[model samples]
Target: MADNDLEIFLTARNVLVELRLNLAKAVSAGYKKGETETAVKSLIEVQQAIDVIDHASEELEELDEAEHDED
Candidate 1:
């Protein structure tokens, strides 16, 4: 893989990691505070991030395919 490809992949992966960590922390905080609603809200945020990342991944795949077609 090219260096640029590796960088993009790593960045995307790091985003996922950060999102998961933030979500986990939110859940823990909500539980500690006995706030189910807040926890659920945080989950929604996490789901949105997952959706965004999934979309980004799909786009990247499409781009790669297009590049290969050009070659």
Candidate 2:
């Protein structure tokens, strides 16, 4: 794989992990404080992170296909 593709993949994966951890923390804190809104917001953030990673993966796949076409 190209260096750029590898970097993008790694960054996206890391961001996804970060988001998951953040969501978990938010849920824990929210429960402790009895704040449902905070937990819901955290869930939304997790979904956004997932969408970003999915888009990055799709773009990488397209780039790979284009590169293969030139071979």
Candidate 3:
């Protein structure tokens, strides 16, 4: 992978991690505030975001491996 692509991937991964953490905190706070419905919705959205990021990461790894195989 190119240096810029690697940098972008790392940055995106970091952002996703931070976002997940923040969403978890929101879920907890929402529950404490008795907003169960909103909390559940936020949790679902968070899970979706996590799944997308995981899928993308896997695809990137596969692409990187294929690039290596061509050498």
- Candidate achieving the largest lDDT: 2
Could you tell me every candidate's TM-score relative to the true structure? 0.57, 0.58, 0.61
* Candidate 1 residue runs with Cα over 4 Å from true position: 1-34
In model 3, where do residues sit more than 4 Å from their true spots?
1-3, 6-10, 30-34
Over 1-71, each residue of candidate 2 has an lDDT whose tens digit, in order, gives: 66577577768778877877877777766465546677677778877877777787787778888999999
What clash pairs does model 3 have? none
Show model 2 residue runs off by greater than 4 Å: 29-36
Best by TM-score: 3
Q: For residues 13-59, what per-residue lDDT tens digits would candidate 1 score against the true structure?
A: 67766877776777766455546566667767766776776677777
Please list the C-alpha lDDT of all candidates, in the order they appear: 0.70, 0.75, 0.70
Better-scoring candidate (TM-score), 1 or 3: 3
Among all windows of 10 consecutive residues in model 3, the one with the lowest summed lDDT is 30-39
Q: How many pairs of residues collide in model 3?
A: 0
Pairs that collide in candidate 2 are none
Which ten-residue region of model 2 has the weakest summed lDDT? 28-37
What is the descending lDDT order? 2, 3, 1
